[model samples]
Target: MTSNSLFDNTETAFKLKSDSELERAYFLFKMISKEPLVKIGTAVTKFALNINLPVEGLIRSTVFDHFCGGVNEKDCMSTVDKLFDAGVASVLDFSVEGKEEDEQFDSTAEKVIELTKFAKNKEAMPFSVFKPTGFGRFKIWQKITENQHLTDAEKLEWKRIEDRYDLVSKEAHDSNIRLLIDGEESWMQDAADSLCEKMMEKYNTERPIVFNTLQCYRWDRLEYLKELHQRAKNKGYKLGFKIVRGAYMEKENERAAEKGYKTPICESKKATDDNFNEIMKYIMDNLNDIELFIGTHNESSNYLAMDLMKEKGISRSDDRVWFGQLFGMSDHITFNLGAEGYNVAKYIPFGPVKDVMPYLIRRAEENTSVAGQTSRELTLLKKEKERRKL
Candidate 1:
């Protein structure tokens, strides 16, 4: 705990009701910091073996309890109600990932639409999101992005993707539920962006019903934000942009090297941060032209948003912009900002323990990979504990 925090009457922290939450967050932080928990490398590595060694039980108790609303919609009743009591809402993300087979792709899209149905008539969950990879095989997605020729079978596979998206978007539009399309790896992102833009064109006319995630860590996305905004303007539709720093930095650079192409990453944290805040400013300056969601844990970036809201003369609760943090890591930011009456939502992804494993592995790696993220979480937890004298 910082001495400053102690004197600031850390009792204010109590209002967050995060004492127990911090304990769980801290434990997970320490546990995931170890290499054994964040498995990667050759598909059949020790990490993979270790993940299967009955650790699912432990993960369900700790991370699932803290992060997920639940594995299924009905199961989320308790968490949803609890968050509502705290003046926060949820963004339901069904976290089933990585299926190479077509049947698996089709099933994921079906589940996404089903999840949307489950959320209909439900007030607490305002939005539902899908990854384009959920609808198309990764290899097929790669082919489509490169504009390379594909076999007859591949064209059929691509059409199935279009059907899945049309099905999901129809349900979302009909139910009046917002759709958030998550960004993918750099290699396959062009297709994701194109599909998301197509949906936004169809659904985001008067209001932003389809939101596309922009990963600002890519050197070009800041400018792309403006380009997309301009396209939306020319085409006469509202633009929905969710600004995130990015997710697949390591894999992106690695693949670039393998393919012998220039890396698309921003090249430095400063550049990424600069681009991130710049995009935020751009969207804020044109709020009527766009809806913005700031999906980041960087404090400065988060505050930059608050500053923008003030400068634009918009209230904290104005729906034009939303502040988001992942499920467990930034409760202080999420809850505090929500407490201040800013529009906020937690990216609440849930699924069967086994189905969500890859997501968990990335999460474990995220806390460690993002510079100081682990220690920053620890420091907050440690502060709350000392304040509670626990």
Candidate 2:
């Protein structure tokens, strides 16, 4: 397909939405475009939910519907079917957050395994994902990061975390479902990365059944990718990777400031973007041993990957490469890429209103903070709506 035939076709992008739904998106994006409003709204919504106020309905109809799949696995099926019909795939992400108990971790692991099983033999659902922090204790990760000694009881607790990872990855391998380990705060990422590498060694020998996320916004990650590549080469296993600019920029900078250490994050968006694109190129050059999932909303990076694929004579249907955007937020990129026969999927997060609020708030804040992201979304929606007019 021609380059022009790609993402500019907003009509194909929003074809899944009804006219009223498109209008609702227009209004929502317009509202979120205001930085001050988003800040106040996020704080107020969190406070309201914490106080047991009845704001679920308002949230469910607006941002929640626009950004997430649904309130549960069952509720997400219609969305899965819709995207599949449009030639896009689905990655069901259980987006519940902020828990620290052993039982909670075990439950999260089970839910991840259940999602992987649900995806088995299902064409629409190609992959399932979970955050390591969701199933591993944050304090354990912190202590390990700081080189602090653990007591026997704490050692036993760490054993349980390892067991949970083994259970989930074993299920994914047995079920033939691809599993992505979501990236988290920098402090906790070393433990997660090690666990992901261990799983990749176990499950990704013949094919990539496990993926570790690389957050390119962190200045060290490009060098880190080089290290991971060397390890994969030495171990003789295919490396599965998901690349993103990252999520915890503000937190990372704040912590670095408070601790009087140089920040790990790139100093500017340009540096991050450049690092991300360079990583994309590096992975493309090593496609023989790397399976890549390009996860971003940036148009330039998306196009750069597409161009790399074409230049390398990689087929659009190549299973080793995929482009992913969050559901409902980047329909133009997701659906148009799908229309062109490129492997594409959405990160369709699902959970109850209260449980999913943190994810929702992040989406809101990200849109507001990212330069021109909200305005760009609004522009595309308006273009599509105008095109549909007689």
Candidate 3:
């Protein structure tokens, strides 16, 4: 199929969405398309939940139901099955965030382990994911990255975090499931990158079971990738990475400005896009040694990957290369790619309605900030609706 037409099959895209679901998706995108509404809604929702104002039901019915798979892994099975039916797989992401306690970190680690076991033999669920901060305090990671000396107690805390990474990575390796380690803000990312590299050294000796994330919006990431690629080759271990245009551009630049350091982010949107495509091409070139899980919502980037695959004589269903999008958004890319015999997975975030609010809020904010993302969703939903009506 031509790159121009690859993602245009709305019928295939929305075939899995019932009329009601389609309408709800359209309405959600319509709401997300407005910046003022998103800002207001986020504040109001946070306030309501903070004051114990029974809004969970309201949230569970609308944004939560649309954006998340369910409140837990068990609750996500139906969505997993449905996506699998459409030839797309699911990556169960326990999207709870912002915990600092070791107990909470252990709990999150257990949850990831359980999800890995849950995905063990399941064809529908190919991978599991977790954030770095989900298993450790953000400050601790930042301290490590900044080369600040940690207190003796802090040394113990860091050990626990490393243990959690090893525990989860070992479980994923044992279960024969791929684990995606999500990238976070730049300050904490170096430590996380080191830990993930350690995991890759351990679990990826035979193959890529532990995957690190590369936020391609950063100007230095291509260089970092090249350095890592050379290291992996020298070390004789496979490398796996999930590359994205990144989610924290504004916060990244703000912190860099406040701290009087040069921003690591690309100068402009076009620069970030160019960087993303370049990183994808670099990974595509070295696919033999590096497995890639492309986590993107950009049509042009996806089309570029498709074209590159065709040019390289890579099989359409190559196991080393997979495409990913979040569950609620980008159905056109996910489902259409799946229909065309590509390996596609949706990152299905799941947690309690209250706990998942931060992630949901971020999603809404992201939709508003990302130029034309929500509008593209609206366009596709509207086109599918019109076609169905006809």
Candidate 4:
């Protein structure tokens, strides 16, 4: 494997964006960098939408354009094409959030299945993803997790959620496209884990057609992954997982504090970072039986994984090891890694702007809390602009 500076080349990284687009990205990040401004902006954006204001144009041109692929699956193909041209893969994530009706849940399930069919036989688009909470009520999931006996109607509702999972998994299995089930809060994860485990048992016996996400910020996820690994071995199935530092820190911490429970989150960022790297090392060490998709923006951890692959004498082009970052946030990691002949992909989420506002808000909040996330992006854009003499 070639040992290149993973993030030093701005040209290859920003080649996908033209000067105008790059400038827009810089301006957007600049706005996001002001912490108080972002908080105010988030509140105002939500209020405007609630009163049926015409803010979709503003949102669609800025954050939505940067973060999401488009308003629909067909609309995402242009992005899929561009990334594929650059040798990067696409995981088409249906980004619609906060749906609760039975009809809405069924529609979300069918949308996932349709994406699987669309991605079938497409080398550029290999994976389809969805969040369980998007398809079912969160309270139901929490109740199921607590093993509380459900009323007859709640039992039926739970069955509907399980049926949706079965349909989504079956479609992916039939289409031979991998499916990633996004993880949620700790209270609801056990139910998600159970449904995903059932899919893995049925579809993963042949290969890894289904994957469950592991959020490493949770203190218990490392042990959870270990138990899953042991179960995979005993059941004679390959374990597939997408690991991340996690996305729900504030909500988790706030809820734990409100409920007077010990937080499931790691005490410090360093602890979460340490846990993430350790889990990645474990996966690489057991690469023969496990497939790993690393979803992180941390440059050091990315390099650490590359070094581990080299140390283990694993080929950089190995199929089992893949890297992922969000569509418009971590172009440096995605494009540079793709340029280096490693398997890399962007999590390209698409949905109507109004429907995806919850996701957009979370992304904004994440940038605010991630300490220099926006500034880092702004710095890279400035460097590229300078390189281009713009």
Q: Lowest-lDDT window of 10 residues in candidate 1? A: 1-10
Off by over 4 Å in 2: 1-5
What are the Cα lDDT values of the candidates?
0.79, 0.89, 0.94, 0.90
Q: lDDT by residue for model 2 over 1-390, one digit each (tens)?
A: 247446678889999999999999999999899889998998999999999998899999988988888999999999899889999999999898988788988888999988988999899988889988898778888887777999999999888888988899899889988888889888888878887899899888988889899999998988988898899889988888999999889999999999999999998999999999999999999988988999999988998888889989999999999999998788989998998899999999999889898888888888887888888889999998989994
**Per-residue lDDT of candidate 1, residues 309-373 (tens digit):** 88779888888888888877677677777766888888888888777767866776766778777
For model 2 the local lDDT of residue 81 reads 94
Q: In candidate 4, which residue ranges exceed 4 Å CA deviation?
A: 1-4
lDDT, candidate 3, equals 0.94
Top-down lDDT ranking: 3, 4, 2, 1
Point out the higher-scoring one by lDDT: 3 or 4. Answer: 3
TM-score of each: 0.91, 0.97, 0.99, 0.97
Worst 10 residues of 4 by lDDT: 1-10
Clashes of each: 0, 0, 0, 0
Give candidate 3 misplaced runs (Cα > 4 Å): none
- In model 2, pairs of residues that clash are none
Model 4 backbone overlap count = 0
- For lDDT, the strongest prediction is 3
Residues 256-302, candidate 3: write the lDDT tens digits.
Answer: 99999999999999999999999999999999889999999999899
> Which is the winner by TM-score between candidate 1 and candidate 3?
3
